[model samples]
Target: MLNALLFDLDGTLTDTDALHLLALQQLLQEEEGRVFSEAEFTTHVSGQANANMCRYLFPERSLVHHEAFAERKEQRFRQLSPQLQPMPGLLRLLDFAQEHGIAVCVVTNAPRANAEHMLRVLGLSQRFACVLVAEELPRAKPDPLPYLSGLECLGARADEALAFEDSVPGLTAAVGAGICTFGLSTSQPPQTLLDAGAHRVIEDFNDPQLWAEIHRRLDVR
Candidate 1:
């Protein structure tokens, strides 16, 4: 039987990818006089941790530089948190899960502060049973550690859990953990997400396919 739902934070629960892109554009341009386009942002920045992104984008820069840029970028993101919007039908899904006695967990590669800010902004700070931060783990997304930890926390088996993500890394992590991963088409394109190992691509929580799967999973109980 289906036992739990694990979700990604940033692009999955709320619509904040645009804010991240804007922050990146302004910061990158002001700090390095480089033009950061949407395509580049989606490819290199989305689904990645701050330090990892900085290292990948600026390998020559010192650790201090990476830390500073990550701090500044995160501060800017918090400033834009007030504009965050929860995914449509998200409340309905949560209510359904609660009524069905299914566990829910949030698994993300976002920094702790950023994750807290986003959940608070969405008024979902107290919703989940557990919040797993990839940064707090020895290995981040694409390593399966975080998602596996989430399942362990919820006492749910991989075959009994459903994971939702909007980025390649998050989806890869969940799928690698042996969970059925659904990709949200919010930041990355659908095909891009599928190529990363997502079993299904959904527009949002309101997606018909998502609801169908929800029913199929719970009806067995």
Candidate 2:
């Protein structure tokens, strides 16, 4: 039985990718005189941890510089948080999960502050049973540690949980931890998520196909 649902906070639950992209674009232009296209952002930044993103974007910068840059970028994102919106049908899905007595958890590679900010803006901070941040774990996405920790916190087994992700790294992390994973085609193409090991893909929670799969997975009467 599917006892719990684990969701990625940014792209999966809310359409924060565009905001993040905008924040990065502004940060790069102001600090490094650099420009990034959406495609470039998808390839280099989306789904990546802050340290990894810093290493990729500023190979010559020290760890301290990277930390400062990341903080500034995240601050920009928070400033743009007023534009954030929950993914279509997300509220309905959350209601369904609650009505069914299914636990909900958020597992993200984002910093705790960013995650909390997003959740608060979306009015979801109180809905989740647990929130797992990659920064708090020894390892983050693509390592399975964050998702594993989320499952453990919820007292859930991988086979009894469903994980929703929007990026290759998040998909890999959830699938690697043995959960049945669904990909949300928000930041990445469905094919990319499939190649990364998603069992299924949907544009958002509103997709009837996603509901069909959820019903089957939970064996709902």
Per-residue lDDT for 1-221 in model 2, tens only? 87889999889998788889999999899977999899988998898899888999999989999999999999999998875688999999999999999999999999989998988888888999999999788998989999999999999999899999998889989999999899999899888999999988988888888788778877775
TM-score of every model? 0.96, 0.97
What TM-score quantifies how close candidate 2 is to the native fold?
Answer: 0.97
Error of 2 at 132 (Å): 0.5
Q: Where does model 1 exceed 4 Å of error?
A: none
Among all windows of 10 consecutive residues in model 2, the one with the lowest summed lDDT is: 212-221
lDDT of each: 0.90, 0.91
Error of 2 at 186 (Å): 0.6
Q: How many steric clashes does model 2 contain?
A: 0
79 in model 1: Cα distance from truth in Å? 0.9
The superposed Cα distance between candidate 1 and the true structure at residue 134, in angstroms, equals 0.9
